[model samples]
Target: MAEVPIVVHPAIEQGGRAVVVRNEVAGLAHCDREVVEFLRRVGLPLSDDILDDPVWVEWRGGRAHDYEAA
Candidate 1:
């Protein structure tokens, strides 16, 4: 199988090391409404907005492999 491309959010660094890394879906869905609207206007799936909340970070982390397999 071909390796899927993953889009990680620009890392959030603390003390010069990355402390947070979220998938593009989670990052974009959590971004400003205008950005979400633009993505929606472009016909991208919006069903994953549930990934936006910080509470879902661990869940999203676990799912990173799924993205990588996409």
Candidate 2:
């Protein structure tokens, strides 16, 4: 499959990451579930294990599914 164009931006000071779909701000996500929810809102398909799909999700400033604070 091609890249999903879904970007889970770096977590802010509050440990919440911004979910962006196609350059649009879907919403703020605090966990992996929220990221899935945001992707659904933007009309994206599931990949069985989306959070671990590097081609489906672009994670920055953090590891995949690591939105929690340090």
Candidate 3:
């Protein structure tokens, strides 16, 4: 299968994570719901468990619920 284009970058200052899609910045998501929203905004098909779906999202520098830098 193809690599997922959506990546939830590490949370940084401003307490948000940078959501990237296809090498472009989609938006900063602060929570799981927001991440889902961003994906929807980009017209991507995602399940309710998107945060846990490795095939759909690649989480880096933190876990799915990590919204702050460690």
Candidate 4:
């Protein structure tokens, strides 16, 4: 007799949501409009908890990092 294999997927329901997942590709922001549009799409103004994430820390510029710490 032959056995069949089963495949499992984690959190399949959460797909297609606006979340900052690591290692996913990010496009270059060509202009200020693109930046604002991305933020708007992600449902900003984000809460402090969201802002405190390490991914955000890594992506922010030096000046913005200073403001984040303050």
TM agreement with the true structure for every prediction: 0.26, 0.82, 0.86, 0.29
RMSD of candidate 1 to the truth, in angstroms, is 10.3
State the weakest 10-residue window (summed lDDT) of model 1.
11-20
lDDT of 4 at 31: 33
Ranking of models by TM-score: 3, 2, 4, 1
lDDT of 4 by residue, 1-70 (tens): 3321111112123222122323332233433343334555655554445334443423333332122221
* Residue 25, model 2: Cα distance from true site in angstroms: 0.7
**Model 1 lDDT, residue 37, Cα:** 57
On lDDT, the candidate that comes out on top is: 3
Residues 1-70 of candidate 1 have per-residue lDDT tens digits of: 4322223233232211111233234233333353345445545555455235433323223232133221
The whole-model C-alpha lDDT of candidate 4 against the native structure comes to 0.32
What is residue 57's positional error in candidate 3, in angstroms? 0.6
Highest-scoring model, TM-score: 3
Give the per-residue lDDT digits (tens) of candidate 2, residues 1-70: 6766888888887888998888889998998888888888878887668778777778888777787655
State in Å the error of residue 26, model 3: 0.6
Candidate 3: give the clashing pairs: none
Model 4 quality (TM-score): 0.29
lDDT of 2: 0.82
lDDT of 3 by residue, 1-70 (tens): 8978889999997798999987889898888888888888889887868778788789999777789877
